[model samples]
Target chain A: MFSKESLDNLILSKRTVLCVGLDTDPAKIPAHITGTTKQKVMEFNTSIIKATHKYCVAYKINVAFYEALGMEGWQILFHTAEYIKSHYPQHFLIADAKRGDIGNTAERYAKAFYDEMPFDAITLSPYMGIDTVAPFIRRGKFAIVLALTSNTGASDFQLQPMDDGKPLYQKVIEKFSEKFGRDEIMFVTGATHSPMLKSVRSLVPDYYLLIPGVGAQGADYLTTLSNALNASGAGVLINSSREILYASSNDDFEEAAAAAASKYEF
Target chain B: MFSKESLDNLILSKRTVLCVGLDTDPAKIPAHITGTTKQKVMEFNTSIIKATHKYCVAYKINVAFYEALGMEGWQILFHTAEYIKSHYPQHFLIADAKRGDIGNTAERYAKAFYDEMPFDAITLSPYMGIDTVAPFIRRGKFAIVLALTSNTGASDFQLQPMDDGKPLYQKVIEKFSEKFGRDEIMFVTGATHSPMLKSVRSLVPDYYLLIPGVGAQGADYLTTLSNALNASGAGVLINSSREILYASSNDDFEEAAAAAASKYEF
Candidate 1:
C-alpha cells in the first residue's frame, strides 16, 4: 500500500501542485498534434504529456474524453496512464472520473481505478452517502469528493440543506472525514468559490482540496489559493485544463504549456 | 433513431429479454479463455459470448468489469461492445455503466455510450436531477434510470422520504417520465421488491422497467411478473445474471444458461 508520507513526498519533490487536466477533447486539441483525422487521440495525449511532463506535479485525465471515442479512446486512456506512471513515477496521476455507488459496486470501482489503472487518485461524487466514498479511501489512493463546483447546475442539489439544517456539502466533509479519516481523502471545491474556501479549511484543516474552476470556468487563482489554505498550510490543488493545454496551438506546444503553468504555484 | 415499434418488434422476435450481465470477474472466468495472461480478459469475455449468445435478448456489461483491468480491460470493453453489435445485432446491448451529470458532461457521456460505444441502452442515476439525465434520451436510444435498485443501500437515499413526504424515487420516476416523454426511457426496478412493482406500474403504465434482482437475489419471477404488468399487459424485463451465468460451471455452460433463461418470453 502507498503511505500518506509517500504521496506527500511525491507532491513535495514535484515542486508544483499544479494539475494539468489531460482533458484532451478531440475537437479542441491543437491541429498539429492531430493533423487531420479521427485517430491521434492517444498521440495528442502523448504529446501533451511529453510537453507538460516537467511543468506539473500531477496529471488528471478526465475519463470521459477517451471514453467518448470508444476503443481507440480507451486505448489512448490506458496508454496515457501507463506512459505517465512508467516515465514519470514522481508525477501523481488521477483518473478524473467522478464515480460513486455502494460498497460492492464501489469495491469493483476501486479495483478498476486503484488496482487496475495506474492513477494515483480519482474524483468521486458523494451523493450516494458514505459507503460510496469509503471503499476508495481504504485502498490508500486519494478519493476526491465533490465539495462544491463552479457549474450553474451546482445549485441543483449540492448546496441544498439536508434534514439536519447543515448544507449537504458541509455534511459530506464532516461525515467523510469522520469515517475515512481526512488524509486519504481530498475535496473538490471550485476555484471560483474562493470565499467558501476559508470556511472549508477551517472545518478540516489538514486535508488537500482539489480546486477546479481556475481556468475556463473563471475562478481566480490568487483569491482561491489564499482562502483555501488550512491552518496547517495545506489545501487547494488548483487544476487547470484548457488554459494549459490550449495555451498555444503552435509548434512550441510543450514550452508554451510549461510557460503557462509556471505562472502558478501552490 | 430506435423507435418504440422497433424496440417492441425486436424484443418480440428475439423471444427472450434475459439481460445477461457480463460483470465478468477476471478471477472467476475459466483459466484458458482470458488468453496467455495479458489478453486473458478479452479471451474470457469472448468465450462467455460464444457460450451464452443464445437464450438472451440483451447483454449488459458493467463498465466496472472492464474498467477494473485498467487500459487492457478498457480495450477488452471496447472490442466486446463492438463484437456484440456486429455479431448479435438482434440482441439489445446495455452498457450497465451508470452515467449522469451536467449538460456538456452528459453530452459527452451520450456520445461515449450511444454514439461511440453504441450500446442500445445505458443505465443512469437520476441523483443530479432531470437536466442531468436529458442529454442521454436522444431520439432512438434508451436511457435506463435507476428507479428502485436491488441493493439495500438504495434505501439510504433513493427510497428515503423527501421533506415533501413522498419517496425520492417516486418523484424521480414522475419527473423523468414527464421530461423524457416515457417512450425513450426505462426505469431500473428490481424484482426483489415484487410488491412495489404494482405501484410503480400504476404510475408508469406504458413504460418498461428493467428488473435486476432475480435468482440469487431471491426475487421470484412468478411473484413479480403478476404484479408488474400494466394496462397494455406487458412490463418488466427480468434479469438473472449469476443464476444464468454460473449455473453449472462444470460443463455445458451455455446450454445450462439457455435452459435457465428459456422460461422468460419477451
Candidate 2:
C-alpha cells in the first residue's frame, strides 16, 4: 500500500520516476534462456526485476502478456508479483491491467489485485461511470484511471469535445478528482499526448500521472517529463516496455534492460 | 466461431436468449458442495452450466470473480470455459472481462481470451479509443463494447452529452459500428436502461446487444427484452447472474438456478 507522499519520497530518493513495464512476451524473451514458455517468462521477469529494480521506483506488470500464456500465465503473474513484493519491497508495484466494471464486479477485481496479488495500484477504465471506479479507491491503494491515451484511436471519443466544449478526458479527470483525493487516485495521461498533458496537470495538479508510450511508441522523454511534472517535481511515472525489455534479444538482455532503464534516471 | 447469422440461428433454435452469467464467487457458492474454494467453484460452475444449459443460449463468465479467487481462479475459469465449450458447443461463451489498453497490449488481451481461452466474445471498454478495440475485431470472435451501461455512474461520462448533442455512448456505437461490421461486433446495452435500448437498436439494428442488470440490478426482464429486440425479434442476450446463481443457497442451488433460468425461457 502506497500513499502519494511515499510515492514522492521513492521518486525523490531514487532520483528517477521511471516505471519499467514488464509487458513480457514469451516469444520475445531471449532464446538463450531455455525452458517452457512459462518457465522462460518467469525467469525473464525475475531476472529483469533483479537487474532493473535499482534503476527505477516502480515496476508495472502488464497482465495481458502473462494472460496470453494460458493457465500457467496466472502462475507466472502470481510468482512475479510475489517476487517483486518480497525482493524489492521498497518499489511500487503496479498491475497494468486496465480493468473496469460496475460496483460488485469492481469489488471483485479489487479483491483480485489488492488482496490476492501484491499490487500497490491497478489501472482502470472509467468509461462505465464512477461506480466502476469506486471499489479501487482505498486509503493506500491507488486507482489510476485512463485519461488522454496515446493511441491514434484516442481521436475517436476521448479527445472529442463534450457538450461543455472540453474533451471527454478532461471531464473524466475533473469528475474523478472531485470524488477522490489525489492520494487515492491517479490518472494515466499518455506520453504520446505530452503537449496536452499540461492541461491534465492543470486539472489534477497534485496527482501522479502514469505516462506510458515513451520508448516504443516514440514519445520524447524529456518533453513528456517536463510537461507532466507537478509542482513537487515528482508526479509522473514514465514507462517504457518494449524499448527496455527487448533492448537486446540475447543472453545479456537483463544487462541491456538495466542500461536502458539507467538512461531515464534523473 | 460465431457470426451474426449463426447467433440469430441459435436464438431461433434455443427459443430463449437468456445468457446465464457464471459470476461465481467462492463465498457465495453452496456450502453443501464441499472442497477447496477452487474445487468448489469448479463444481458449482459445472453443475450450474449442466442444470441451466437448456434454458439459455449463452453463458457469460465474469472474469472478475475468478480473478478474485487467486491462481486457481484461472484454473476454474479455464475448466469452466472448457466444460461449456465441450458440452454445450452451441452456446455463445462470453468472458465478461471489460479490458481496454493500447494496440499492442490489446493484441495480448485478444490472445489471452481468444487463443489461450475458449471465450467466443470478450467485453471491452471504448474509453481508450478504437485502437484498444481494433485487435478484438476479428473473424469469428465478437468484441462486445460497452454502450449505455446500467450503473448510476453511467451518468458521469457514457451518458454525458457530447458537443454533437448526442451522448458519448452514442458516438462510441456510431464510430465503432462504422468501422466494424455487425457480424464481428456486439454492444453491451444495460437492461436497467431498457427504455434507451430503443435508441441503441436504431443505431445498430442487427448487432447483438448483451444486456446485463436484469435480475440483481432490478431491471424488468420482460421490458428489457421487449425494448432491445430488433426487426429479427432477436439481437439480445439477457443475462442474470446472482438471481439465477444464488437462487437457493442450499444443496438445491443448481435446481433453483435452472428454475430461475426456465422462467426467462421464451
Candidate 3:
C-alpha cells in the first residue's frame, strides 16, 4: 500500500523527492542496446533502475512511449513495473498514463494498472469528473490528478477563472481533495508553474504534488521546492525525465542517469 | 479523411447516426466462441462488426478493455481496426482512449493511434491544454475532446460555473472550436445531459458531438437527438456499448446486437 506514511518514509530515507521518469524512446537510447524496440527499452530501464535506485524514491514510466511500439510495448510496460516492484520494494512506482473514462471503462483501466500491473499510483485526467477518477483511488493506490500543468496549453482552460473567481485547475484540486483525501489522491502541479504552486499548496497543503518539467523543461528546482513544499518539508515528487533518462547516448548511459539523478538530491 | 462530408455521406447512406461502441470485455462475451482472451475479443468484435455494419455508421472501440488484457489485447485492437478498414471501409472508426499529456508525450500518442494504427478519430482529455491535444489533430484525423461526460461526476467539475457565468464545459467547447474547425475536432457530450445539449449545440452548432450513455445507460434518444442535431440533421454519433455488444449473453449475441442496433436506425 502506497500510503502517505510510506511516501513520507521514503522521502525521509532517500533524502530526495526525485521521481525519475522513464519516458524511454527507442530512437533516443544508445545504439549499443541491441534487439527489438521492446528489448532495448527493457534493457535501458533495467540498467537505469539498477544504477539510480538510491537517488530517487519513485520511477514513473510514461505509457505513450510503450504504446507507440504496439503489443510488445505493453509487455515491456508490465515487465518494467514488475521489475521495479521485485527489485526496489521500497520505491513507489507510477504509471504516468494520464487516463480517465466513463465509469465502467475507468474500472477496467484501474484493473489494468492497479491490479494487473502493480503500479502504486497512476496519473489521471479529471476532465470526465469524479466517477472517472473513483475507480483508480481504491486499494491504497493513488490517482494523481492533473491540476496546474507546466505546458503552454495549460492557459487555454486550466487558468480560466471559474464563477467563484478561482481558476478551473484550482476547482479541480479542491473538489478532488475533498472527495478523496491526501492518501488516495495527489495533484500534478508542473514545476514551470512555480508561482502558482503556493496557490495550489494553500488549497491542499496536506496532499502530495507530483511535479514535472524540472530538468529538461527548464523549471527551477529551488523555486519549485520552496513554493510547493508542505509543512513536513516533503510534499513534492519532482520529476526529471529526458534530463536523466537520456543523459548520455553512450555505453555509460546508466552512470550518466545516476549522476543526473544525484544532482536532484535534496 | 474523416471530414464533415465523409461523415455526412455515411449518415445519409446509413440513414442513422448510431456509433456502435466496441467496448468488448472478454468476461462479458458469449460462452460459445472461446479461445485466449485476446482471440475471444477479436472473434467477438469481428462477429459484431459483420452483424451490425448495416445498422450503424461508425465503431467506437474503448481502449481500456483491450489494455486490460495486456500485449495480446493490443493486437486485437489493431486487428479490429484493420478488419473495419478492410471490410467496412465506409464506416468511421474512433479510438475512445481519452488520452492526453505534455507535447512530446502527446506526439507519441498521436503516432500510436493516428500514424501506427488506422483510427479515423481519437478521444482526448483537455485538462492538459492545447499542446497535449494539438499533436493528435492532424491530416485526415479527428481529435474528439471531452466536453461534458454522461457520468454523475460530471457535476463535480464540468458543470461548475465559470467566472463568465458559463460552465467550464461551455468554455472548453468555445475554446476548442475556435482553434480547430468542425472538420478537425469534435466534442463528447453525454446523452444523459439532454438539456445541456442545447447549450452545447449553441456553442458549436456545426461541429459533430459524440453522445454516449444511450441504451444501457438509460439516456433518452429522442431528447438527445432533438437538442443536439446540427444544421445537416446529422451532428451526433450516439454510442451504445453494452446495449449493442451484450444485447444477448447467449450464443446468438451477434444476431441480438444487430437487432438492437437496428432499433437505433433512423
User: Per-residue lDDT of A115-209 in model 1, one digit per residue for the tens?
Assistant: 76777788887655666777787655788887777666565445555565555567668877776655588888776777777878888777788
Question: Stretches of candidate 2 above 4 Å error?
Answer: none
User: How much of the real interface does each model capture, measured as fnat?
Assistant: 0.39, 0.96, 0.83
Rank list by TM-score: 2, 3, 1
Q: Report how far residue A235 has shifted in candidate 1, in Å.
A: 2.1
Candidate 1, lDDT over the whole model: 0.73
Docking verdict class for candidate 3: high
On lDDT, the leading prediction is 2
Give the CAPRI class of candidate 1. Answer: acceptable
Candidate 3 local lDDT, residue A151: 93
Highest-DockQ candidate: 2
Interface RMSD of 1: 2.5
Candidate 2, residues B1-266, lDDT tens digits: the string is 89988888888888898999999888888888898897888888889999999999999999999999998889889999999999999899999999998888899899989888889999999998887898998788899999888899998998899998999999999998998888888999888887789899988998889999998899998888888887887888998999999999999888899999999977
Residues B6-35 of candidate 3: C-alpha lDDT, one tens digit per residue: 897789778899999998888888999888
Candidate 3 lDDT score relative to the true structure: 0.89
Candidate 1 stretches greater than 4 Å from native: A1-16, A34-47, A50-55, A101-105, A192-199, B1-17, B30-54, B193-199
Q: Look at candidate 3 and give me any clashing residue pairs.
A: A162-B162, A162-B163, A163-B162, A163-B163
